[model samples]
Target chain A: MLEWIRFIFTAAFLAAGIFILIASVRGVYKFDYALNRMHAAAMGDTLGIFFVLIGLVFSAPDIWLGAKLVLIIVFLWIASPVGSHLIARLEVNTNPIWEKDVTAARRTIEEGDTHGHL
Target chain B: MSKRNSNWGNTLQGRFLRWMRFGWEPMDVLLIDKMSQDRDESVNDALSAAENLRDLQLSEKYNADTAIEHSIMQELDEWSLSKGRKIVNRLYALLSVTLCVTVILLLLETVIAMPMRGVAVSPTNNEVSQRYIEEGMEETGAVNIVAGMILDYRAFDTLGESTVLFIAACAVLILLRIDRDKDGRPTQELIAAEEDDRSHEPKSDRILQGSAMILTPVVLLFGIYVVLNGHLSPGGGFSGGAIIGAGLILYLNAFGFAKASRFFSYKTFALITLLSLSFYALAKAYSFYCGANGLPSGIPLGTPGSILSSGLILPLNICVGMVVACTMYIFYAMFRKGGI
Candidate 1:
């Protein structure tokens, strides 16, 4: 029964890992901007590696090794988001996106009037 | 406007067109023909100037003739102003780097060379050792080996180490602490407010958030375990402190800054840091007093392989760990909040 439980847990972790990887790839292809792409990359790094490392920790032979693995997971958890945020900020500052014909939308929202061109 | 248009049409095609339309009236012909010729000459001069500019831009690698002229002018300017400031600056930087490397190499060589020598230099063989041993046994009543060395034999060194840690904690806190009222205008606040107005909003992933929620607790527990078992194992103050700091960072990431800040407030962190350093200092001072005068020390080093073995190592480790963890978290928070 214990062996079976371990096997099922391992399989679940593996599936999660694969799912995250696939989502990251799809997100990269689907996103149009650097900010969106950064989201995908951050997700891939933190969640994708978390699943894999957690699985390995459970399967490892000793407590010391598992503890070291946990350290790596913790480091990534702290670093990945901050790194992605900085990169996205840099991209936004360097190459900003211009709004297209949003004056009518703004006017309608502000004055409760909708006569201008959309 | 007419002159500008004429200049635009001054290439070979424009001259060809002018030649084709040569059968107009005398006044028209003079105006058109003379203007076209002048335009053509001006266009050719502009093209040559543009080419020269491009050559100057690329002259660094291609070794263009104009590059020599530029270098000559630059050299003359350098000679006028003290003759060798640039060279002196370059040589100064080079010398400093070389000196640093040489010093590091010499220190490493000394350390490596000591072990290679067959001389057995024991700390206990010196004159200080006899006095220390007599005092340690009289005060601490511990006889194993390293414990006696740390607690009674070289208590002064241990005291200095703790004092160093306390100073480090104070320095980090002072450097990282934010006081916008005192400073008048904080640069970080300005940058953050500007960034907040921009198009890009902060992004987060729900899936990662979910996983972090589960992992964070486990990491925290392991960190505490490392700190708790520091005396028994090879791990001690520095490693255990780093582990706990990592756990704090994990919590910070799992929950956003607002939530993490709820548990780890600036006031609470500052108080804890002050209290921990005070505790370490008090412990060391008590040991120092006992060793200086003729007083019996209460702290005992249990059997070597036992869990509660080290005389004061465990308590010292815990104090160091707390100071390190608090300072690290404070630094991280300051950086995250753009206090720098």
Candidate 2:
């Protein structure tokens, strides 16, 4: 019974991960802008990897392998956001047509919007 | 001549096939009937058409002041020619990229869903796996069975893969490398390329540079470790080499081509790739010859699990790593700026 439960959990998680990844690809196909596609890509890079690896950890042959999977998740979570930031910066820099959509501000206070709490 | 040949178009079999294909062929039946009736007339029509073309060409040549026949190729102006080529290239790139991405996604899905490590009853764990697992350590003298299998057992295949990468790099070089004058000065095109980079590429972005400064050395060190420990770990030459190449790319992005060229240039890439490939070829050849002719591979297979245990696998791994690294870095350099 316990093994069956674990198997079900693993399957569910794996399915969810695959679904999210497919959704990410679909989003890329559907979205017009590069930045929007990158947003989808970043989701796949972070959350999809996280869910899949976590599922694999449940069925991992050994503790060391599970730990390694977790490490992979950690590394991706750290790096993916940074990578997305760099790619977005590149997109903004190279393509000047996005200027109208973008509003530049040096400080948070200068934007005249104060709704969020730290 | 027309009477000598049978009217094969209106034959029973042809009629049957045409009927089957079109279902109700009012047009085809009428056409075939007309064709069978007017065979000589059709030939005469074709000859007359040729004469008309010739007459048209003669008139164009004699009467027109312009050498170019605008009527035939009026659409292909200088601007349209270049623009059409660009559009075609872009379309080709888009199609290929989408195809590659779809294939990769499907393959990834398959691999991730499949059970990887252990199984009592499975197709993945066949005789091949058993052979590799049981006798791999004894024959190849490497802890990592995959590394042993790829490098020692199937060295020729890896050699071919390396050669493919080298050829690709060479092709890119031939296509994109900037030509220089006799005195080794930058040509006009090269100067234009320099100005292009100056205008577009990142000009010392602090965040990227700072992160790269902290990360590049560690990434390089990890790549070296992966390459050296190929026989003992999951990673081998190819993956390690790619990692090293990524690190080099990061370094190049952080500090421009000039900084990268201090240690690695076109000369460095050419030399490393040449020496490594030659060494790999010679070693593989020696192994193949000895194995084929029933002579012992004289090189001592040291104790397994140790880095130095695999006789030629380590050196072979290093050679592959060098070639792959050079090829990857040069590919990027050539694509970014025609020369390294």
Candidate 3:
């Protein structure tokens, strides 16, 4: 019963992770702007990775292996956000017509708008 | 307008032609807006943005105006005679494809030539390999046979590989390293303040800096552990050093080069790499001498599986780890900016 439960959990998490990864890739292609593409990529970097690692931990043969997988997840969780933030900042700074592509949320903040396109 | 069309025509090829034909340059929006303002101003704006006519005339850096005209004429000549160039490019592409196919075929042929299949007693499973498996622990005093072979039996080859890495770093320094004066002093340009480029930085994201500060020590500690315990387990100097190097890179990225370079400058990189490489060479040379002479080096191999058991392997691993870590960090630093 315990083994069956573990199998089910692992399978569910793995499937969810794969689904998220496929969605992220599709979103990357569908998005028009670099920032929008980055948003999609960042989801894969965080949540897709999180679910896959969780599934691996569930299926891990030993406690030490599970712990190592958890450590990897922790490290990625810290690193991925910083990487995404840097890439987004680069895109914002370099793209001259960046202001023209502003969404409704960003367009409301007039003060925040000036610093971006210039 | 003729000049712009000529410029585009010179480099016309398959994909670029298709893209240009589809009107990919979104500068049309800006151009249309300029045209609406004034008919005459549209050409001027397009000329400035597309080709910078004024900047070209002011700078004699390319030589006299006639020389610039000469180059423009040469480009036009190439554009007019595009057919021959196109054929040459196609021939070059064909040659490249043929070369790639030949290489792949050779590699596959070699792979197919090998006949060893499944649990069959191949020549590799002979006395030489069996001897190493049986006596690896006793002779090398390392529980891990792979570690014993790499650090003891084939230590010389590993030494050579480490030297190769060191030489590669030197080569990169020669090619890409900039603004260093005689006696290897960093020029004022390299050592100058980052105040001018301050606007480019993301202004020390607190989350990144804080997490880096917390994680760096733990990562470094883990790297050290892996390097030291190489003989006992699977982890080794190369991997451990990479981990430590990554930790340092993360710290550098978060804090910026100004803070990071205070501790790890070009001088520090030079000192650590030189000391580690020299020590590695000397130690390996001594080990080789003893082995060739068939005399015991008097360095006792400690009991198997203990941290101290593998006499020279532990110290050698440390040397390699230091070199690898320094190399990794230096590569990052040099590539990111010319300095440090």
Ranking by DockQ: 3, 2, 1
Every candidate's CA RMSD: 21.5, 15.8, 18.5
Could you tell me the lDDT of residue B65 within candidate 2? 46
lDDT by residue (B17-49, candidate 2, tens digit) is 778887947567978778867778878789899
The runs of at least 3 residues in candidate 3 whose Cα sits more than 4 Å from the true structure, single-residue gaps closed, are A98-118, B1-82, B85-93, B119-121, B180-199, B291-294
Give the lDDT ranking, best first. 2, 3, 1
Tens-digit lDDT track for model 2 on A6-101?
A: 788889889989999999989989999999999998998888888898899888878999998987776677567768878887797668786544
Candidate with the greatest TM-score versus the true structure = 3
Report the lDDT tens digits of candidate 3 across residue range B142-204: 887877888888988888877787788777777666666888876776655244345565555
What's the i-RMS for candidate 3 in angstroms?
4.0
CAPRI quality level assigned to candidate 3 from its DockQ score? incorrect
lDDT of each: 0.67, 0.84, 0.80
Name the regions of candidate 1 deviating beyond 4 angstroms: A1-118, B1-159, B172-176, B180-208, B291-295, B300-311, B338-340
Best by lDDT: 2
Residue B191 miss distance in model 2 (angstroms): 1.6
Local error of candidate 3 at A97, Å? 2.9
lDDT of 1 at B216: 65
